[model samples]
Target: MKDKILIAGGYGNVGQVICSYLAEKFPGKIIAAGRNYEKADNFSKTTGGAVLPMKLDVAENHENSSLLDEVLLVVMCLDQKDTRFIEACIRRGIHYIDITASYKLLSDIEAMAGLAEQNGSTAVLSVGIAPGITNILVKHCKQRLGILEEAYINLLLGLGDEHGKAAIEWTVDNINTTFDVVENGNLQKVRSFEDGKESFFSEKLGKRMAYRFDFTDQHVLPRTLNIKTVSTRLCFDSVIFTRFFAILKKLGVLNLLKLKNFRRLFVKVFENFRLGSDIFAVAVDAIGEKEGKRAEYHCSIIGHKEGIITGKVAGLVAEKIYNGAYASGVFHIEQLFEPEEILKELEENIEIRCS
Candidate 1:
């Protein structure tokens, strides 16, 4: 009976949180899978057998794996270089949820919508905080502001949170890259950490200067929500930290991140440094028409431990996919879920305000 839930990279920081959350509800049916058997086993021991450990590498082919045969759903916590593993899961009619924020990779998987539908598999992308909650909040704004035209997403991440290597690596890698964002119904070239814009987060966070960041939410929302213009900006909780990156970008010093050693050093510094509060804030501003007049909608959420909120959101979405029947195909979180539904589940962990 394809009853097991396989979580790739299950022993890692965010994965363990998801594993523990699901294990409590589905006990003994959650499998924490990774290439490191010892680490998976060690993490499983902490669950008191509620979760099982499995030695499975997502990078390898899974077509012939007997373990995959018993898995009904696969929640990915690791970043993949290609979509072969995802194709394998869909080919077997398994439900899929990914926490990755990679726009290029997500577009590739989206191209396989026909394949997923044919195989009766449902795949949910943009399942983490920025893309996850940010996506949901924008959708809510659209709902409130009828005839939505443009939306701007601003993210504030804390330095004190325990960021995983992948997250830090991704941050460093995109420090000096160029990406496209929809503007006035056309794509415009934008550089990371450049073109600072001040955005109000909350009473506690105040207004901080946010810069262009290549978060996938901006890319997906334009097509998924049919919005003409969408942009996502990023900033740190600390005012000084946010300005430092912008200054580096303006002076072209951020280009040094292209080097492996410099990238590694920056990643290490972020991992060890704990200067700001362990808080994450996401805010969205929507412009459109309500009752034939120009109107604007605003929404925001503030929370502690970005990774935990991300894991909890993934776990909640997974539970829905596990127990309910969703349309089989590739879809972003907002396309299939209401923001109120998700925010309700996360109310205790997050502070949300909408207007």
Candidate 2:
């Protein structure tokens, strides 16, 4: 029997993509585990039993599960409110990958670096779009500009795209919260969606008014790359929706989105609405000194179906880890893989622009 690769939340919007991709790549080695046994079973049936369904809840204690004995890796497709599941993975020496963009959860995982190293296990975080692809683009730009002084990342998401529930909830919850960011070599607090800037992504994406958003890249890049300043901004493709949110943010009405019921309602509304295209874009603006002269570099990627793109990135990372491409420790996507190589792999799925 082959080593089992368990995917938590395997029936979810993003998890289903990961499950399907891995099942095709590895064939019968994928186990779709989640809280809903019926949904998992149904999905497995749809896959012609290539993906085995199993019931596993991260909320409960997993240290004693027999399933852990047969699993080689755990791909977390859902949000974890705590670190117990990660600790359990480390204790059992299971390789892990998470697509979460939560700064606090990532920090908690980073705290387990020593334990992961000691157990000869690997954990890869920041495995999705904003933090994943954005981080890789920043690394590329930083390398292009020899002495990197500052970097800015801009992300534009299509309002019509079918986002996952967890992702929608995360955005709504953070829309009004304040977070710390590195600015001019000093830490500063900024309200999410309150501060705005204009950026040109590409001729196709055009210029967009992006707002300061609390993405994990802004927190991880400064210390990892030794950069002086970094910031991340977000905007939607719809001009009217963008301006509407900006107005709500200015009026302090965005805080109402922090409520669970309101967030759920917003997610439902967003999932049902399809006013814009399904295209999403990411751009990086880097400024530094090279040859005693100032230099700048810009890179952008435009694609459709972000959920699938994120799943493909996670699946590729998991395959590399399974093949012993990464050392035993906790790492971000950019830390373990070269941006150029990753971009090459994704060339088929996305349009890349560099200048």
Best by TM-score: 1
lDDT of 1 by residue, 1-355 (tens): 9999999999999999999999988999999999999999999999999999999988888877787988999999999999999999999999999999888889999999999999999999999897899999998998898788999999999999999999998888888889999998999999988888888898988888899999999999999999999999999988998898788889988888878898888888999989898999998988999999999998999999999999999999999999999999999999889988899999999999887
Q: What are the candidates' C-alpha RMSDs? A: 0.7, 1.3
Number of backbone collisions per candidate: 0, 0
TM-score of 2: 0.97
Error of 1 at 233 (Å): 0.3
Assess candidate 1 and give its lDDT. Answer: 0.92
Candidate 2 lowest-lDDT run of ten: 317-326
TM-score per candidate, in order? 0.99, 0.97
TM-score of 1: 0.99
